[model samples]
Target: MNNKDMKIHLTVDVWAAQKADARAVRFDVFVIEQKIPVELEWDDMDEHCLHAVAYDAAGHAIGTGRLLPDGHIGRMAVRAAGRGKGVGAAILKALMAQARQRGDAEVVLNAQTQAEAFYGRYGFSRDGEEYYEAGIAHICMRHVFS
Candidate 1:
């Protein structure tokens, strides 16, 4: 990795996600980039979910993910500039760590259809038929570990 890629740091916090940071990153990736509706972007589950945020060296929020008590991971988003640079992986590792700490043997998520392969790299296996959420196609997936 180059200097720019190596300079970023990953921070994972359970129930510690800041609203401002989550909104900013979500706005950049989901709303502006993916054209997702703002009203749908933010939801009631946020307040009850454990969120993880990744920051670039300049202190900009570059990635975000959330884990629910039932070990459901969702809303994983990496900024355009931060994509393909390990931010997503790092954030995922952090979320898994949170799950492990809570004694979860696995984590589940409804992944976007276009991103199934990406989640597969992290050991998430498709478990059900394709479904729609927020007007986008998704697949139910889960990560199992010993």
Candidate 2:
């Protein structure tokens, strides 16, 4: 269905980094769909990060993202069914809110080349030349809070 015709109900929650729902959504989008290595998917940093998960009306996790203590945002993923439904934006917003609440002056993220424009819309600007991570093209992006 087209976006306008679809019923879009998204609930975003911020929690400790290892929350199951957040991990599940990231697994589906990153490891499963994008083929990122399992070893790279689960990292030591998770325990110290702030996580955001987006759930649909059916209570299924649809998207996830994380904000690191050093103001780095990463691991953003949105399930295929949730694409174009604003689920990713919801997840990012939740992460950014948490960052602001923590008194961060800015947040940085490595945006997949194809999704750079998506982050750009949120006021993130490219900070470096394109590079590869997990064998996929990416570029560093940063958003400064005013």
Candidate 3:
């Protein structure tokens, strides 16, 4: 755990001022860096999703992810400066903890093909065939609750 012990204390409301950092991190990673279409990067579902934003020691947001009400996790993004420093892992652990607290039977995500092993390291199992979304390869993965 980092400074906040991996607790995602940001407001889940998309309209909240707290969401700006999360949005910035995602936009930088998905839209600018990955070239994902802007239209594909946002959705109405964000209004109801639980979001987790990771902050660097300097208090700048560096990573983020969301856990949908239906237990589908997505929008995982980490800035280049934040990768491999456990920022992604902290955000993910926070999101999955939120899901478990809500009694979700399982947590699911469409992980980038390259991140399959990373998610697998957290007990997520891949399912179905690989597919392309926003021109990036992805595979569905799930982590069942015990």
Runs in model 3 with CA error above 4 Å?
Answer: 1-17
Candidate 1 per-residue lDDT, tens place, 1-146, comes to: 55545456766655544667877888988899888989988878887888888889899889989988789998899998898788888888889989988899999988999989988999999999999877889999999978
Worst 10 residues of 3 by lDDT: 6-15
- The sequence of per-residue lDDT tens digits that candidate 3 reaches over residues 15-95 is 254478888998999999999989989898877888888776667888888989999998999888888777788778888
The sequence of per-residue lDDT tens digits that candidate 2 reaches over residues 39-125 is: 988988888777777667777777788888899999998888888878788778778888999899999999999999899999999
Best by lDDT: 1
Reference-based TM-score of each model: 0.90, 0.89, 0.90
Pairs clashing in candidate 3? none
Cα lDDT over the full model 3: 0.84
Runs off by more than 4 Å, candidate 1: 1-6, 14-17
RMSD in order of candidates: 2.0, 2.7, 3.1
